[model samples]
Target: MTNELTDRGQERRDSILDAALTVFVRDGYHATKLTDISREAGCSVGTLYTYFENREELLAAVLQKVQAEIGNASDEPLEEDFNRISYADALRASNRAYLVGYRANAKVMALLEQAAHLDEQIYDHRVARIRRYIDRNRRVIEQLSERGEIYPIDDPFMFTTALSVMISRLAYYTWVEGFFDDSDETLERVAKTIDDIWFRSLGLKTD
Candidate 1:
């Protein structure tokens, strides 16, 4: 929907999306208003309408932006050559990256979960998005097994799904629910624990 905008127009649209995210995180999706976003963006409600047809469209755009940021945050680990690095190190790096991304988007992710319960479309999108992560990681596990870097698994897909769910729940509790302090020490401890699980489950040597 934003394809035809000039560079300045696109910038304005991006600002609106950022503002929407801030407001949504602060006041929540159901409680947020276009005027709140406009105020945060230092624009008028009319200007917001210029970028988005309604509050729903604006929110969807904000959600898309958040999703993109989260995706980018963890992409670096995927590009690493596992042959050059130990599998345990790679898994630790990947887990830390994923947790960092999840921590950054924690509030918005929680908001997304709330929206999912109320909106079928959001629910479906959330489910599909998680499945995509599972599928991607399952492929990675299969490749690592084929390379004989990890033990052969009878059901890599299910195993990946389980690990993904465990990590996701840990992130939700640690970040969204504030189960632990957001300290570097805490992050390191959590990452190491996750690494240990992955290494043990895959029968990879940790030392």
Candidate 2:
């Protein structure tokens, strides 16, 4: 539906999406209305309807935008050779990227948690995102095992799933719930702790 928009139309659509996200984060998802988003976007309710079918669709789009922003913050170059990097360095980089991204999107992440419980679509989307991360980590674990870089696990997929969930919960606690301070020093310490756990779990020697 959005594919046919001209550049200006696309911009308007994006603005509406941004407004929707802002409102969602400020007010809980069920409490937010299209009128609220329209006011936030400086557009009319009719204009919002032109860009989105309904509040649910707008919320889904906002979720997608948040996920895309997080992905951009955390994604590494495809061509980079993970095998050549020290395990500790690789783990440090990954943990730092994830925590930084989570911190940047802390409010939205909290909103997502709320929406996931109230909306089936949001819940499915969140589950799918986690599955994708687990699959990616599992593949990496398999590759590293093949190269004799990490200890052979009895169930790589299960191990990856457990670790991925742990990291995600830790990020949620530290960032979304504000369980700890968000200073750079605190973030570095969190990343190092995650690195140490990853190294020990995978039976990789740390330098």
Q: Choose the strongest candidate by TM-score.
A: 2
The count of backbone overlaps in candidate 1 is 0
lDDT of 2 by residue, 112-131 (tens): 88888988888987898789
List RMSD in Å for every model shown.
2.0, 2.0
The local distance difference test score of each candidate is 0.81, 0.81
Give the per-residue lDDT of model 1 (tens digit) for 82-146.
66876566667777888888887889889888888987767777887788778767876887788
Model 1: how far residue 163 lies from native, Å: 1.3
Clashing residue pairs, backbone N/CA/C < 3 A, model 2: none
Candidate 1 at residue 109, lDDT?
86
In candidate 2, position 109 carries an lDDT of 85
Candidate 2 lands at a TM-score of 0.90
* Per-model TM against the reference: 0.88, 0.90
